[model samples]
Target: MNELLEVLRHQAAHFGPELARTAFQRGLAVTKKDGTRQPIPITATPVILEAAEVRRRCELAARLSSAALKMAEAVLGGNSQEVLLGGLSPLERAIAERTWRQVSRLATTRVDFFVGAGQQPRALEVNTTIPAMQGYSDIAARVFLEVVARHFRYPERALASLLTLNGSNALALYRALLDGYAAERPGQMPETIALLCRRHDAQISELQYLAERFREFGADADVVHPEDVSGDDAFIAHGKTYQMVYRHLFVRRLEENPSPWIEDFFGTVPGRKAVFLNPPTSQVEEKVTFALLSQALATPELAEGAQLTPEELEAIRVSVPWTRRFRHGPTGGPMGESLEDLVATVAAEPQRFVLKRSWDYGGKAVFIGRSVGTVPYNERAQALYGAPLPWAELCERAVADPTGGGYVVQELVETSPEPHVLCTETGVLPTSLYVDYSAYASVGLARQPAWGGVCRGSMAEIVNIVGGGGVIPLITAEVAHKLLMAWKAL
Candidate 1:
């Protein structure tokens, strides 16, 4: 544990003073919904789970996947013709099927191994199409590789070069486009890669980092808002032509503020190109695929094609007991009467369960009946029964309203009491781990075997590191390697 902690600290320090300062600045930006800002706690202590416990967790994860698959199959029947094929164009259906297969395989290969204490890893959501953070993870790994190379004289191998070829970081991606251009044209490498972004300060800062990095690699990169570019040729001002366009803007935001003129400008030009890091298909992210997975609509054909099995499906159902109408509560008590019966069951034993919206995100619209006490429950229940929109109806309205996003009734997961270590300026501070799961996907024939990846960590750590605080680095490479090995074994 001490050795691992030292490694983590060393890794964090290796990014240099500038990166550290940037991380601190970003750390200050951490704010809660209540408008409270909190500094990130940086610790130099290892939070170690015993190897035996880790194995148990992995086993439980497998069992949960089995359960979820079974439930999905029972709902979909033997064929996924309706669930998989419905409301999709041929191309869309093909893509969806591919994604489904990848996610299924990923679930079987990765998710099944993280279970413990009857706690199976349930899918938080499935991001089958246009998954974000691939670039981010790649960048992090690259940063680590760079540090190791510079200081340790680590064999002088070409690991960084190999890794760079596969990564999608802003710099690496632009370089790839240039390399492709050079391949086609023989003598020429594109002079510049234009980054399109909104006029936000944070976006500007990100683009600046990208621009600086691009310059470091002998390429000119500039930040241009959509409005700045002109005509059906949103060409840059310089005599040099843009070899590639990299979109850094938020897709939804850009769509909301459609630069039709800019679109026309780009569309009209020949040989001028653009690549969207996250294209329009990102709307899929808004739909909670995890909730969809638990639904009867997700068929067995879908599960089988995705590489799910009976055992994995059973495990999922057991871990996420709320999915089944018949499953019992956390305290070995019966669940709901009809799921409507669940309301009554929850009402009777408020302490044992909480009402979760079907498609809740970021922990909103989560009503803990025990927290509110019995009197409020009676009032809310009465209102639920009496209102034009009954409780279920109200939940549906909330989900549809774009804020609540429906809800799922879930028994609170009883996490083991463990002291968490938070990295602080002074050193390690004790904290609690709020575990969540993330699913990732990779492309190409090489990536086909393992459709996606799963990573588990304390929620605080994930948020901190993702927000640039460099807290607990995500286990992307570790998890990816594990899944890849599993796929090879299969």
Candidate 2:
């Protein structure tokens, strides 16, 4: 562990005074949620899971996400569709009901996991709409491997086989768009592909990187804001007409802030012509998908017979945690028990569960049971609805607001602390961090297998990059040794 710390110190030195922070900020271009670049706070020691184990988790994620997609799609035709999708807003539910033009449920997504003591990987959420951080992950992996190879004698060739690149995600995304176009409009491969997003998106750099990659893969690519596009059935950019367009903004935002461009994109000719990357289906993005999966696991028949296969059901039970849409009625538990009973149980042990919004992202509105004690939890409940009666009142509030914008209560996953040394001004400061493994899922002809993934660490309960935590680059022993020697020489 000390030797590994040595390598991290050396790599940190190589990046200049701030060490990895400088490289991360400039090289990786880590951006905050406010569209400003800041110094990255990366841990020296990376959590190195076995290559096979990483692949297994990734495969599980694919299976779970695919199954959830099918289940969400089933809402359009299923008899219990209304009850099943009661958590989504009417607009989101309506959007989900329609078959998207050429595109399927989730073309590109991400499954976040936390592997704890038993080494069993527990999935936190399925980011089915717009998943970021792949560009950073790709660059971090490359920098670690390349820098280590120059300074250390490691099995570079073998390691390459074992690990996967973040580039696969980019390739998968572009391939999905092109293939969808091919199927819908054969023999007319799109010459230009445009990435359409909001002007102030913090992930602009990532979008730019993907656009550059699309160009590399033999297609003209452009990154433009929503307001940039005008006219009928075509987006005009720099005097060129873009046939294929990738949407990075969510449907909720478009609805909340309606403009001429937004209205045209969702309502008029352009909405039908320009191909959306995600196709505006917000149901898949809802946290209720996990709740549905949890419910299905409890009562397989609740899946409505032929909608989900036994294997798919198994995947849900295996990967997904116990979840339920927070609502204001007498909800049925997985085993047909009353929701009131579940609430009573949760009240007895509030620290074991979490409550969050259904369709939100960036870790907003997440109320961890342990993080916020009984007083704050109740205070939050009271804040939601002017008065606080009891735990039952909160459950009622959740049920009352069962829409696409509803809230969900999920079982809290306990992740084991990963030992890490933070490289700082004085020296290496030892600390323990809770790490999360974020695996990217790409839509393609077959399952796009992922081996290695982006690992982020945080001292706080939440391990999101936006909250000051940063990426961890997994390297070998030889590389660590060289870094130690290099640091000593310095």
Candidate 3:
């Protein structure tokens, strides 16, 4: 552990303090709605995985993606429509009904898992729409691996033989665009692909990176804002017409305010003009989908003649934690008695549950039953739910209230802390943190989905890069083994 810390310190020194400051201020710091900002943590030491473990996660990601796609199809197909779509808001339901004319229900997804005692893997959540940081992982891995090779004098071939190299999400996205084009146009190749974003979006760095990468790979890709494109018969951006538009903004926002821009992009301009990467459907992005999967697992008959097979249902059941989408009452609130019962249950065992919003991202609107102290929990709950009954009641009410439109309660899987040190701007130092095994799965041109992943380490209960958590490049098990051996030999 100490040797790994030393390696990280060396890497941080290589970047220098000036670059770190610039990156943190310009890139890492997240600006909240009230104009408050905080730096995003980054660790030089990476989370290492066994080759078998990498394969297992990849396969698991594929399965989860398949399950989510099936669930979306089931909702769209009217099989248990109310049961599957009941938990979503009106806009979500409307979008879920608009069948993606060209793409899969799930174009891409990220399965976040926590590996507990005896290496039992339990998925926390499935990020079904526009999962970010795929390209970041590739860049991080390249930099870290290069540093490791330089410091230890390892040959390129040896590193290549050990690692699961080439997980460029930018490439995967480009291919997915082509697949959508082929589906819509049939044999006619798309000449230009536009990476669409709202005007003055913060993710300009990522957009530029992906655009250059797409161009490098022989695709005429350009970063264009929605304002730049006119809602004409043909979608034109930057003086060039585009066949496909890769949306970087959330569909939920678009649904809130529908515009000619959206209609033109989605081919609602008389006839279908351009293919939207992730058609404005936020239902698949909601956490309620997990609850639906859990429900389907319990009642196989619910999936009768559905796209999901019995075996797939079983897989989803074991992989996802026990979850339920809380339903609202007729008087515009949670079911009163059921909410009370849920509060009582949380009071009995606070550590077992976590409440999350259906459409929130970046660790916002999350309440971990175990993270708060008894007094604080009650106070927070009371503040949130108009007078807290008890810690348990607070937990229950937290899940019941649809403050953010909808909510879901998930069984909290214990994520044991691992021994590690912080990779800071100053230097490396000891800090115990929990690590989350997260994999990004995308269905591109290939028959089998490709998987790239990141392992986030955080002192906070929720491990996310946005919440002062450090991201480590997830290396193959074999490469990790060799690195361990080398460290020991040293």
Candidate 4:
């Protein structure tokens, strides 16, 4: 874990200018909601992991995501779409329904997990809509390799070999985009794609990088906003026709802010003016899907009429933590332990679980039982419910929110904290931080893409890049050892 950190502390702390230069040219940054830019918080040293372990987590993620895709289809195909997709804002709901029929497959998804002592990738949530960080992960790995090689004066061929040995999520995303585009338009290859997002969307920089990568991969792509797109007999942007429109914007954000061409451009989707990669999917993105997975074994009916294979069910049992819809009704435990009132069970022992809104973003509606007494959680609870209700009251108030599909109670996955060195703008700071692994996947595409992952570490349990958590690059042990040998020989 400290392989790179050890070398940096002892002999290579002088590569900041070059590293920062790579970051700037690569757009390794996040634009704030208020339209300001800042360097993405990251760790100086990548988290060295076993190749087998990375494969295991990604395999688990794929199974779970495939199960989720089937579940979404079953839910949508059944008579009860609103049972899971209700209570959201009108815009969020419309955004979901607009593309509801378009969800035969999920083009891209990133399943998030916290690592445990036994090496269990305890999944917390699944992001089926607008799954990002592909480009960022590539940038981190590529920049680290480039800077380290340049500083140590390694031969160009050695550096090229090292870069080849690593996987690129950007390449994975590009392949997935093409695969999805092909499925949508058979025999029609997409020469150009439009990366869709809000004008000042926080990940605009990342989208820009993705556009650059797409070009390098021999396809033409442009980062564009809704305002620039027009829908005629076909969707057109800047007088050019794109075969695919990759949406990187969130439904909530789209509902909150949109331009004059929003309705017309979005309206073309049902008619297929142009293929929309990963069409809006608020239904599958809701946190309740975890609860459904938790209950799948207990309630076999949840998997009824859906393609929940035995293998996927086994995967859920092993990796997915216990989760349930937070309500006042009776429900069985994840282990089929006993029937208990959902609200009462959580009220008694809040520390064992986490409360989260069925559908919310940026970790704003998450209330961790472990951190209930902490000031930040309390402040957020007080602000939302008009009082810093004890964990019990908090759960009750959350249950009573008239909103449909309200909150979820999830078993707290005790994360194993590890030491890391933050790669801040100024300098590196060594500290122990809780980290989570988020692996990428594609469900319903012709085939799965070569998906790697992104790691974010933080002092708090709720880790998100935009919410102040820094990223830690994931490096295979073999790759790290190779770099170490190269450094030693130098």
Question: TM-scores for all candidates?
Answer: 0.50, 0.80, 0.81, 0.94
**Residue runs of model 4 more than 4 Å from their true location after superposition:** 1-5, 8-12, 16-21, 259-261, 264-271
Task: For candidate 1, report its TM-score.
Answer: 0.50
What TM-score would you give candidate 2 relative to the actual structure? 0.80
Off by over 4 Å in 1: 1-3, 6-121, 127-195, 201-223, 231-248, 251-258, 261-273, 296-428, 435-439, 443-470, 474-490
lDDT tens digits, residues 1-490, model 1? Answer: 4443344445544434333233334432234445344543333222333334344444543443334333333333445334323434333334334333222222112231223365555433333232333333333334433443344343346545534433334443444445545544568876677766666523244455566668777877777777776533436534434555655544334456776655443232123343222222221332222443443223455455445556555544554434322122332233433344443455566466555443322333444544443433344434444433333334343333332233444455544433434444334444555444333322111121122222323533122222433332233333324323432344
How much does each candidate deviate from the true structure in C-alpha RMSD? 10.6, 4.8, 5.3, 2.2
Clashes of 2: 10
Error of 1 at 418 (Å): 6.0
Q: What is candidate 4's lDDT per residue for 1-490, written digit by digit as tens?
A: 4756688555434765456556756877889878878887666667778877777777788888888777776777789887676756776676666666656666788899988888778888888877888888888778877887677766777777787677889998989878887877778778988898888788899999999989999888998887788865666889988877788876566566655465545544423777776776667777776778777877889876666999899889888888988877778765566755878888887778888888877887889887877877977787788777788888878988756478888888887677766665555666788898999888778778778888888887788888777767677777777777777788
- On the 0 to 100 scale, the lDDT of residue 371 in model 3 is 71
Superior candidate under lDDT, 1 versus 3: 3
What Cα-based lDDT does every candidate model obtain? Answer: 0.40, 0.63, 0.62, 0.77
lDDT of 2 by residue, 178-273 (tens): 766665566778889888777756666667877887999899999987667675656776678887877777666666655566545543212356
Candidate 2 stretches greater than 4 Å from native: 1-6, 9-35, 79-94, 97-105, 151-168, 260-272, 304-306, 327-340, 374-405, 422-429, 443-452, 474-490
Q: Which parts of model 3 have CA positions greater than 4 angstroms off? A: 1-39, 76-93, 100-105, 154-166, 255-258, 263-271, 327-343, 374-390, 403-405, 443-446, 481-490
Give per-residue CA lDDT, model 3, range 255-320, as digits (tens): 555655664455331126676556654556567777777667655665663467666676676677
